[model samples]
Target: MDNHFVPKLTRRALLISTPFVLAGCTTASRETVVTKPIVPAEYLAMYDAVDGEPYPVDAADLTRVDPAFLRREVAYNTPEPTGTIVVDTQARYLYLVGENGMALRYGIGVGKAGLEFSGEALVQYKRQWPRWTPTQDMIAREPERYGPLASGMEPGPLNPLGPRALYLFKNGVDTLYRIHGTTEDWTIGKAVSSGCIRLLNQDIIDLYRRVPPKTRVIVLQGPASGYGV
Candidate 1:
């Protein structure tokens, strides 16, 4: 046993070993993209093959889909760090930012005119097959529609929140809005929800699995074609 013959890491050795790290910084300082992440064709194809629904999705229901509502990946240059969820309320598009100026885009249904919610929030919690309950305001607006469900509706394939729900919070309080799933895929790319942000059930389920609690979400107004830098 040679107790005193320990390996040494010299400054020159460290510098030589990490030249690529410093080169990356230099490349970034130049403000030109040297490399970018690309979503593979096979990876993109998986979204179309989502199956094993709790109950079969109506074949007729799936056939009427508008092409614009399909999930996609796009070049999204933003100052926001990777993993931030940016919602363009006016555009009816939600972007999940990722590395090297790329994003996963989802078509969504937003709050109807007066019910729009805007600003920054954090994903406080999430659920699978979440329960549904109309807010008091909803009950007041349409007692006949929501009065019976105020206590909370049980989780099911038909729940308005659908297969997944990402509860948002601002300043440690519930925002009363969710980035949630809905079975009504046709509603996507339309502004027709009561007040919540809605996505296709399959899409939300995919998103829920990707984003964790504490992720920052920015809800923005205006028709910004892509995220801002």
Candidate 2:
């Protein structure tokens, strides 16, 4: 059956197949089947807390999140070494390779248009409850929107960067992109970010604690290019 035609996935369905099918993905390491871990209480609490000053607690709506976007396990047929991170942007999913042909998959929000990242990088560092600093380009495009943030916004639930950030680096240089948490849980499974990949604040907090610095990250453009470990 066509991936597009695939029906809505249950938690169980995700373990069996992927809606965004991987065709001709490059396999480099060992085989592993991916699966989901249990959602923790602390991860869920951040969404309920009123972190941002004016943003209502209600704005951190978890109801809008697609069930499939939640973290879960799935059958990942990849060659990338166990513990590598493979991001299928086109599919809006991130995978952490595991042993014995398995992986832990999470639904994700990708960057808009030309902002999608493709290639090998490393998680050089991580920050908890990070501040938000809008880039100069963001300020130039909409000074009214980002000019005040030139000095950086304090970390909070309202901050677009959410609860944690995993900085991505390439060849010893910053990629200016990150895998971070967002208050906008609804954005998962969509392409609506400046240039960073966003996850539910709860989810990022979960992944942040799991992924270590220097972890290999492989971002595939689309299925046509195949995936790596």
Candidate 3:
């Protein structure tokens, strides 16, 4: 299945998976803990209310969310061309490669299902406020929750797909994987979705506007290599 083939990251894997920083010296009594980065004031505008959509998108409340999970631009070294999307599953970060050795990175929430789909794929198409239908497997796992919407769930703020969806395909066939948005902003850096890669609603809308159909997307496999950014 050429469309389903999973490609591995050869040289870029280490650089993409490495953490930006891991501070704190170890001591017997005090355990080393990674500190959260401070969120910049400009984020207020970045996550501000989005208008003119099918539905109202309120400004995201980031006070309780992790600063690391907030969207930011950072230095990125990748052989892949600019405009390529590199998703580091292990680090829960998705990098949208940009010019001049930098990328716009977003924190993602990956679920067990997301772990199953890895490798290179293309953004076959994108939809704004796309409808969502639970897979047969998903229905079987939780009939009560998904059975009512077996046909499909309409797009809305409450919809699992949030406000946008980027469908992944291999060899011109649908992979049934998606990079979508979620209303649950707290899940940005966690592994708790049913299977899709989820970003905050605001982030997804931003991403949807940046890339178009046929964009290249690479989902990295395996654990992170403890290298510093």
Candidate 4:
């Protein structure tokens, strides 16, 4: 080969090998470096879930707030406080009266017009993370919507009933209506549920801890006029 051709060929070979050399250097540097932050053992333990597994909640989603929101307090009151709890289906408000002009005001989600009801009732019983059994009507109307979970939907963070449920009863009969928590927080101030009253998980959990069994529950349209006689 000619001298000039030899030099050009050598230069071409070196250029082709440059990328491989740089990649090797980077790999070696990464192996020798200790750049990642170390988490303390105590802090790592705190991050574990209740079941001793890694908690799945996204850290960015956590928020700090006043603890008072977790408690049951009478905020809005009425002069008549002697009847069952009255939920205004149209207005999406729940009223729990107290003595001396005090009531607990809770935001709620009500059923649509054709699905709502106005009547006297009581909270017959309650459940935590209640199992969802779709009614026959619901299955018939939208089999595709519920076919997968036909037997029943298990309780979890994704449950439609977020954390608690209060089953309503009228004259020793279950009305099949519920005042329960919802996974959809955006629906709290709307009429979007089938026929159940939906509350925020935090709110219902707070309410569940406060109310006792067999507490009177009444669902009404618009606003309640007179107290129960």
* C-alpha lDDT of all candidate models, in order: 0.73, 0.73, 0.78, 0.59
**TM-scores for every candidate against the unseen true structure:** 0.74, 0.73, 0.79, 0.65
Model 4 misplaced stretches (Cα beyond 4 Å): 1-83, 227-229
Tens-place lDDT digits, model 4, residues 1-229: 1211111112222111111111212254547633333333332332222342121221110012111221133444344444336686765777665444445556688887787757878778888778887777678878999777779887777777666898888889878788897656567678898789987665676467556667777677755555321
Q: How many residue pairs clash (N, CA or C atoms closer than 3 angstroms) in each of the candidate models, in the order given?
A: 0, 20, 1, 2
Ranking by TM-score: 3, 1, 2, 4
Highest lDDT: give the candidate number: 3
Q: Tens digit of lDDT per residue, candidate 1, span 119-184?
A: 899989888877888999999999999999989998876788987899999999998999998877
lDDT of 3 at 57: 83
* Model 3 / residue 155 / CA error / Å: 1.3
- Put down candidate 2 lDDT per residue, 67-151, tens digits, no spaces: 5676776767787877788888988989887766667787899988987888999998888878889978779988999998899
Q: Between which residue pairs do clashes occur in model 4?
A: 76-103, 77-103
- Model 2: residues >4 Å from true position, as ranges? 1-60, 224-229
